[model samples]
Target: MPRRSRTLTGLLLFTSLTLTTAGIAGIAATANASPEAPAAAAGAHTAHKAAYSMPGMPGMPASTRASGDDPDGDGYIMADPPVTGVTPSMEVPPPAYFHEFQAKCAPTHTAPDDPIVYPGQPGKSHDHTFMGNTTTNANTTTASLETGDTTCLAPGDKSGYWMPSLFDGDTKILPEGVQTIYYKSGVTDYRSVRPFPKGLRYVVGSPMQTQEEFKNLKGTVEGWECGDSFKNYNFPATCPDRQDVQLNLRLQAPSCWDGIHLDTPDHKSHMAYPVAGGANYNSCPADHPVALPMIEFKMAWPVNGDMSNVRLASGTGYSFHYDFMNGWDAATLDAMATHCIKGGLQCDPHGYDENHPGQGAVLDENYELP
Candidate 1:
């Protein structure tokens, strides 16, 4: 994986623009898989991620964070946010949660008749070793535990293989209604998504009308190229690539949605149709469960050498999530208005679900969204 060389100035400016335009927070998430050669955990580890800090909220101090760490043994501190008296709507039980799910989620289906092939083994070569790009022996209980069952699956964990650990064995997976925006590693899909900042277009679902209602929003958008072609392994086409291009931006919306609630549609069932005579348009679900007015975008790609900026390359994606306060675009805004009104939901900053929490008359601080 390569380090990006974007300056704080561009990130800061984009952050401001995103916040104002979307009435939401801006955020970024990064993922890095271990190197290709197998080595003991004690071996020299080169894989690493850079640190990032969010802008301060009013009445908040810069040096505030909770004590404790992630029980998953990822080596990163999973501290509580600074905002006191606040808790996420999602109720993820602590360490006990993992141990419990491990037993329950254990797959009932028998392993495939073929022997598991470990990737990156010294003299012994395998399809996953080179093409999948990781040194983790894909054939052991430890690997399963580390990867969370077969969900530890290399690129396309989202769909293929039916790994049970990802859901932590909980029968309740994110509702099928949840939709996810995807950039399939290969394929000329670039034409389907446009760069941001050309100007935000109102999504068809917003509850608020009138230019006046949306007066305060603004954002910036960019796109990254994932080399030139698509190839297949055992994974799904939508899996993030190790060397995919990245797009980063910040956005903000007006007061009407500020502190307002929005709904998140069940994106899984939505139909994908290529846009008019152009590219295939994937129609997102028209309605969502929660209406949210703001969101942030962050993306990353794998680079062979040290990288300070975007470069044409071939690889997979890490992770993409949001920071509820900094950025958002028109599509999110329209959904916010429409869903908030229809679902009667509110914005919950501490929400763990994919959408913002805290709004709606039935506001349950402990509720979790997918």
Candidate 2:
């Protein structure tokens, strides 16, 4: 994939008094519009933002910073700055918990058998490991997702999450254990957290940039580690003599939304991340007021040495990106967010359901790679 680029231009137009009056009249006529009016407005704004690239903006590319710029100068990028000052919301009671669920991995090839990949273009895409819904694809819609079969231990979860497949030569490597999903608040203000609206979709990270570009570019989140005991994001982790090296990758999707648009034309402008300074770590900007649960991807890939042969469908490890399509039922998602997340109760995988007990169930817990 190639990096997307666009030139920014500024123009000053002088309108005649007669034209200006006409424009004002049109605006006034549309001021008291119907509920559908906002959708049109959001679409126009999204289109404009896509045409003008804004580097270093939150939903845009990350800003250039030197301290963590591959401090060790190794080929791999490091982790991002740790999230600080995350004081759980006091309004919510103690024991704020996460809803855990396990799902089976699906192949991400474009082939017909690979349902998660876009339809009709099989060989065009590289292999990826997917989880969540079993029927996701290019033609998948919000309605279709609601009705699609799920891979999650809890049959109710239909949302899909996926990343590039780890490989050694032509063989694919699966995680040592079942891949788990942890849904919790990234900040203390749990009261403001909300469920992901149905049909919401977004992509984090870039597939076109190189390792150097990923390391130096603003907004890119990539890192590596050895074993499970990791310390800082300054350097790649080193594996002990017998253990496999791991890539500790984290990609945080934008949480704040403009509220009206399920997705923007740029697929990002409608959302924003919490700023790094002071106590505003999870604060959403005024324009993007509605706060949705932040989706953070923390993955460990067992790829030890010689990354030269390690390549993703996008590029290399540094070019990692993932796609999410919301398929969760509205009421159930809302309850989990309100009761478990906001209420600070670590509910089981069944997600606040009374019938299912324990910490939910793990799907394919016994399954292993061939």
Which of the numbered candidates is closest to the native, going by highest lDDT? Answer: 2
Give the residue spans of candidate 1 off by over 4 A: 1-221, 224-270, 273-346, 349-363, 368-370
Tell me the TM-score of model 1. 0.20
Model 1 lDDT per residue over 243-288, tens place: 4332222222121110111110110111111112224322111121
lDDT of 2 by residue, 1-370 (tens): 1111112101100111111111111111111324653354344334322322333222232211111212232111211221223332323324434432222333222211122223222332444566667666544556677777665555556786766555444445544433445565655466777677655665555454456645643333545455553432333423443455564665556665555445433334445554332444445544455667766666665556554454443435565666666777666567566756665555555444344444332222332111
Off by over 4 Å in 2: 1-124, 209-222, 228-238, 241-246, 276-281, 305-308, 351-370
Q: 297, model 1: CA deviation in Å?
A: 6.3
- Report the CA-based lDDT of candidate 1 relative to the real structure: 0.20
TM for candidate 2 is: 0.60
